[model samples]
Target: MKFTTAIATAILASAAMAAPERGLASRVKARAAAARGSRPLEAAQKPADTTNKTNVQYSSNWSGAVLENPPSASATYTAVTGTFTVPEPTGSGSGSSSASAWVGIDGDTYSDAILQTGVDFTVTDGEASFDAWYEWLPDYAYDFSGIDIAAGDEIVAIVESYSSSSGIAIIENKSNGQKVSKKLSAPDSSSHLGGINAEWIVEDFEENGSLVDLVDFGTVTFTGAEAKAANGESVGVSGATVIDIAQGSQVVTDVTIDGDSEVTVRYV
Candidate 1:
């Protein structure tokens, strides 16, 4: 009698296990069916290692957080459509190059500022030109833009050094920021502004505008930095701004930036 009872108990346990298995099969099938008609599994993908071992690329809609090292305190930046300033310095200046998003200048390398300075600008309407100068050029020529610009739009330009009689505009971003700076091949008689006083005059906010017209006129002489380079403090006696009456009547009245802004500085 005990042996029979033990066998019955074992059978009852097996049956219970089989019943759950059948229920689990049903649940699994339901889950499979739901998966086919419902949320698909997203396979995780690793970002492709695109750190440009050979060439750096420029981004029109660049966004990220970064820290810059070197003679850094404050920084100055401007775009032609209007100006936006930031407060980070990577000790950049003139006499270097920019390719893609980096600028090599003044014996220093730099990335773009994080744009914390809160500097803003405005335009009066119609046509406008983009321009600014850092002590050095960008790692490539993808440096400044002007007046009125939209995100994700591209503007290609050259860095020029002008002293009136002799000038040169280095084609900084014409070939993907890989080649050495080249002389702008735009013929002098061909109505293209090239060489040191390189100008890109964007026309027809009244109609068609091209990257060729984003221009910065006149050379930046020197102002704020020389004082800091000597005194170690940002003391100022105010600065001057030159606006084109043709560029829609100058909606912005004052321009300000932190440090390492304004192309060159002259001690008055």
Candidate 2:
């Protein structure tokens, strides 16, 4: 997950946003502080040092399943697609249970930055809502306002990095044929989005400097998921590795890349 010249790390250092109930920016900033060891938290609360690998927060993180590719210098990624049921979080504890499923370029196999988009499913106080969003890391994720994303909606999420810092994100509610597409620009070239990495993931983003508890999402499957490299090479999950998020020594979830581009994430 580590790439040469950690330019992207600069971008990742600023990408998180707080949950809706948590005064967004401040919460994200708090988490960032904790990630850098700026805050005093319990020894068991800190995420491990994954300086060169794909870093995952022991608190809020991409905690479900992930399939990631290695960095490529001349790669121009395009057309990453996936379909999944928007899961209702099983918030059995004191905090909300939330998770996000998305596809993007960078983050894993690169530095701190990423150009991505997907759907966020949240269950707060026993109520569930699914929303679609797109993000250029170092920036907050923006929800597609007019699009209605509901639970069990067959969704198709796509990200095409047309240029080094330019891309388009599309989210479609396949069941209703309602979709939204947005053009995005990464904040800086440090993103090194081109020829970096591509990922299909389920993440548990942090809020208020703590990792949010993950919901029992059961299983999430990413289908027809593939990327196109700058060299015109079709990228699949052939050599992709399974990424899991853990707390202490206990691995929490599992990911598997099957065949060429099908990926399944199961909650344990």
Task: Please name the candidate that would achieve the greatest TM-score relative to the true structure.
Answer: 2
C-alpha TM-score for every candidate: 0.20, 0.73
Model 1 bad stretches (over 4 Å): 1-158, 161-166, 171-254, 260-268
Instruction: Provide the lDDT at 101 for model 1.
Output: 17
Best by lDDT: 2
What is the clash count for each candidate, in the order shown? 36, 8
Q: What is the lDDT of residue 173 in candidate 2?
A: 88
lDDT of 2 at 95: 54
Model 2 alpha-carbon drift over 4 Å, by segment: 1-60, 63-72
lDDT accuracy of residue 150 in candidate 1: 26
